[model samples]
Target: MKQSKKIAFVAGVASLALLATGCSSSSTAATGAEGSDATLTFMSTEPKSITPQKEPGSQIGMALCANLMEVNSQSQKLEPLAAKSVTSQDAKVWDIELQDGWTFHDGTPVTAHSFAEAWNATATGSNAWQGNGTFVSFKGYEELNPTDGSKASTEKLSGVEVVDETRLRVTLNAPNADFPKLLSTNPTCPMPESAFEDLDAYEQSPVSNGPYKFISWDHNQQVVLEKWDGFKGAEGFSGGADKLVGKIYTAVDAAYTDMTAGNLDMIRNVPATMVDKAKNQLGEQALYEVETASKQQTLQIPEYVEELKSPALRRAISLSIDREAIAASLLKGHAQTSDSLVPPSLGSYVSGSCADCVFDPERAKKILAEDGGFDGTLIIESNSASDQQLVQALTKQIQDNLGIKVQLKPTLGTELSERRNSQKLDGAVFGLWGWSYMSPDQYLSQYETGGDGNTVTGYSNDKVDKLLRAARAEMDEAKAAKLYTEAEAIIVEDLPAIPLFIPTDYGLQSQCAQLNDVQGDLQYYRAGYGC
Candidate 1:
């Protein structure tokens, strides 16, 4: 997703896709030759794919590969990695000066056109998903008045130009003052032209250009990366740190088991089921954190043009959730019930809908009885939990309260993500959409009129669109935040979704390990950590 301008939180969500897919490391001599001491053991629920434009591909991809730029976690700032610097003189144009001694894994020198070509190729359709909604807004990719397709094809971008090997130029249809920050995701991380004899194949298994290179991945089994000495670095690196070693596992139990045996040295997530035992076992090596959960469980509404636009229904659904029950049973008190679409930890609330954004099963029943337009078939949604736990729980609550029998269905994580994106979600899907509290991009375009990432709910409003555009356009920090607050109030009234608990990322880790700054993302298994 875009870094800060409009897709930051969405990028956090995309980067976490591997949490569902599930990393490998070598043992250091300080620890052993197994790479356990030297490597970080990571776990992801879903398998990762190799598309720069895709979730794992776009943001933070530089940890494994290099891009033209990188985002600094401490400052929430974007800086050049492959490029020397990027400056936007105006809203539509940016001047990027390339770094001097950059090279790909294959030793091909980095070029301005490589970045431009990569952005151009992955700007539409599925590839667009890779970049976390970044270049989807580029002017060259916009197919205005195309006779064949309704939307523009990202086939050949017309806006980005290769001025020279060191400098590149870009033009936008709309004024995007935050363009540089948006390109900080992994997919936008530049690659050497040498890695791709065929662009499609390269998308499947990309070679790294960052501090690390892809070693091997066995899907549900293991994934690995080795250091790339060719990487060009600057401010983003931890003082030119040595190459990172990563390992991913599917089950927390397996990961925890290995780490406790001293076979694993670093992991961001400490296994919760055995946290007590591990705490006794590893002692101070077992670090504890009151971390924030990036995932937000919201009821999705269709962006129906008319007819079935039901805020009341959305409200009723929101009210039906027994958040207390979910927190007590599923989350085990590790989750915080959200009061707004955007979490409050950002030291601010975006929505003014705090009045009805809460648990009220009885009220939900009453609202549905009076206002819901139920079409007979039981509506259900799902995610990557134990046998549709969330779906089943939601169905039981909705039925017990409203007398509507919803047929719940469970699905794989990737499939569930796809259902939301396609928006043809039959009767509605039950799941969560993760957002970043530290960055603003996730909120701005996420719920806009045409925002693909905004599909969290089918519901959208014209006035809401006006609010989004206003917020995005405002350069004054306070004024833009104020606009967002007002817009949030309008959305709360609209009830496209009801806020649910913000759950924590409960992964098992060694006590001394620390992993943060993945944009509040959980399940960023590939993220490196140390004892």
Candidate 2:
């Protein structure tokens, strides 16, 4: 399924019908932490907290609220933070220890029980299933044990019992290698013991244990957060500096105006369409830019896709997409064309399949003919107004090239996600969406058959299943990459969905703080330096 969406549209529809960009000088600004700056302003597509529905920029909430067990940005390898160490005494039981002394924003000392209760709620799927830790829940503790021929999900977690405060144990059903890594991301991220008291308040008022604390989150206005001085692990805490200050604003021009006028300090997603204007107004000392992560806005063909279900049809549809032209004309040559769903940040599995993603009306016609062209209409769902324009453009192309009837049904955010997840709709022009992480396994768990979070299309293959299983079970990175590599071949050949285009991140900032390379998946807040 296409997990990507298009909230990054340039403007409302009709306006997007003709998007263009202009050249600008390469001005630079202070990115992040250049002068021990304590506070920063961030730009984002969503709030900084997690909720039932979709929100961009919420990943910042996860990062700033609490440090994961591990963050991958370190050069020495996977950097472990909160957990001193993690080792499975046996296939089922894993022992863990807390760092010297860690406390939540409320000054409550973190103990084993904090993680235990959170893990229990996430792994058991007993609660509303925040859609956080479905993988661990589906497999259960048994998925960790390599004992003979045992694969069961029933029965309680007899092995993952707590020994005492500050120390904990885990019991897996099999020798699942992904257990630790999984903890580093989602299932293991400690939840506020206070979150469950009221889910509604939790969404609006989140308490964090990361580098920052919640100041306020007022919808229809900027959300502000101040850094947590008590944060034990971050650099600012060691220096006794005030916690970082974060604010989110929807309008870049306003934010940029404030920045240049010296009312605001920083922003992300610098709108590239008006690059020349941005550079001149902001000046070199206040402007910053970088080629963000190569992320794609692709079509996630739902597994049970009603009308465009055929692999041949999906492949042909891929042919109808003109990524380079779209990138050049609309995106202002800010990004590259991509034919494969996986971007170039990770592995060899990424195939430079641009040639296949070319516009070919004849080929699409052939495939439709072979599949027995249906007279019924086809619908597309999307959120960004620009996507609707693009979808309409593509629809026109398809209809003109091949006598097929098509329709554009654009919708997004909660409505779009519910339809996609509940199977209430047939198709949508999903774009500008993807996982925040750079791992292929992230994609697998999102779309593969039986994947707890799978929505776009229920793609399944015995080989991919086996490969995913093997990759998850193997502790070795080399082995894991190999398995994913093989799995990718299957995905490419199967063509369950169509690869759209790799899109660039855009935003406007007031000229206070500039940043280097912004890419990868983020929940909502943009990360860079502040003045």
Residues 1-531, candidate 1: write the lDDT tens digits.
544333211223322432343322211222434444345554445444654556542222445556555554333455555666666644566677887767777677778877876676556553445454566556655552243656655366677788998888777666654565565556576656754577666645676566666666566656565555565453223212133334455444566667778665445434233445665777744544535555666665565524336777777767777777776665556567777877665433644345766678788778877884565655666654332454566678777766666677666666666676666565565555554224454654667665536655645678877876666556556776777777777777776666765655444445323444445643232333443
Any idea what lDDT model 1 has?
0.57
Q: Total clashing residue pairs per candidate?
A: 54, 46
Tens-digit per-residue lDDT, 1-531, candidate 2: 533211110112321221232211111122234545445555443442353212322544554444334432212133345766666632334667677678877877777777766655544433334443343433353333223655434433455566787677776544555555555554455656787688677777766567656777656455666556676552211111233334444445556666666666556544444455666776555554444454556677776767766777776666766666666765577667676656666553556543456777788778878988757765667764234545666667655666767777776344565576566767644656554344667665554555545555667788787787777666566777778777766776667656676555544444333333323432222233334
TM-score of 1: 0.79
Candidate 2 lowest-lDDT run of ten: 5-14
lDDT of each: 0.57, 0.54
- The best candidate by lDDT is 1
Estimated TM-score for each candidate: 0.79, 0.76
